[model samples]
Target: MGDVFKALADPTRRAILDELQERNGQTLFEVCTRLISRHGLTSSRQAVSQHLDVLEAAGLVRTRREGRYKFHDLDTSPLRAITDRWQLPTD
Candidate 1:
């Protein structure tokens, strides 16, 4: 949970999550390009890669390797836990 909060604290990381939500299974290059074209973010690929590392550490993002390429996918189960904890029961 602490990791989730820490990962969500950064705007760049949030943008990365949004990108994944918009289009799952994106490569690092695709993510960097989308962040610039769609989100107007000026972060470099290396910086975005670091951001992805943090997101991966938080369990918010999952990765798969295909040959030499790695794809990033979003995982929202941690977020579901937060929602489940706070949802009011119906009478």
Candidate 2:
């Protein structure tokens, strides 16, 4: 839970998760290029690496290597856990 909050604390990280939701199991370059260009926020590859690390630690995302490239995917179960615990008001 702490990791989830930590991963979401940064806007960039949240944006990364959003991208993963749209297209799961994408290579690192694909994910980074989409987010960086879409948000008009330039980030170094190293910066993207940091975001992935946090997200993985939070259990909100997962990554696996396929030959040369690493593919990342969203692990929405943890997010569902967090959201389920929240008390959102219904209109």
Candidate 3:
């Protein structure tokens, strides 16, 4: 989907997804921390939150709130559409 591609287009967003892939179900704070420590991304919490918003809109990231904490998880099923759309024959 266009949204998926657009979401994956950004380096920062891709890094965020990579972080989630490495450790799914991370809080916003955790994601921010890892992005800085692991990926050396200096984005602020507000900016990273906005990137999460884009990923969420594209169905690449899912968010759920429990009590006072919100967790983010990666969803790669949407990527299947790309493979399916251009799948090669095995004949």
Candidate 4:
């Protein structure tokens, strides 16, 4: 729950999740490209990488190495923690 709240505190991370949800298991480059287009500029790859690291640490995202690149996927289990802990209404 701590991790989920921490991860959701950042808009960038949330946006990253949205993208991954929409298109699961995207490569690092693909995630970066979506973020760049949505935010109107390419932030440094290092910056995006850092954001991914945080999300991964929070257990909200998972990564798999695909050849030379890492692919990201959403892990919604932490989100369920949030919903459960908060007792939020879910439809």
**Would you list the C-alpha lDDT of every candidate in the order shown?**
0.91, 0.84, 0.93, 0.83
lDDT string, candidate 1, 1-91, tens digits? 3488889999989999998999999999999999999889999889999999989988999999999999999998888766687886687
lDDT for model 3? 0.93
Q: Compose the digit string of candidate 4's lDDT tens values, residues 1-91.
A: 2366787898888889989989989887888899989766467778888888999988888899888877888988877776676796677
Off by over 4 Å in 3: 88-91
RMSD to native, candidate 4? 2.2
Order the numbered candidates by lDDT, best leading: 3, 1, 2, 4
In the range 3-45, model 2's lDDT, one tens digit per residue, is: 7877889998889888998989988788779877898668788
Model 3: pairs clashing at backbone N, Cα or C within 3 Å: none
Writing each residue's lDDT as its tens digit, candidate 3 over 3-91 gives 88899999999999999999989999999999999999999999999999999998999999989999999999898878898997878
- Model 1 misplacement above 4 A: 88-91
Candidate 4 regions with alpha-carbon error over 4 angstroms: none
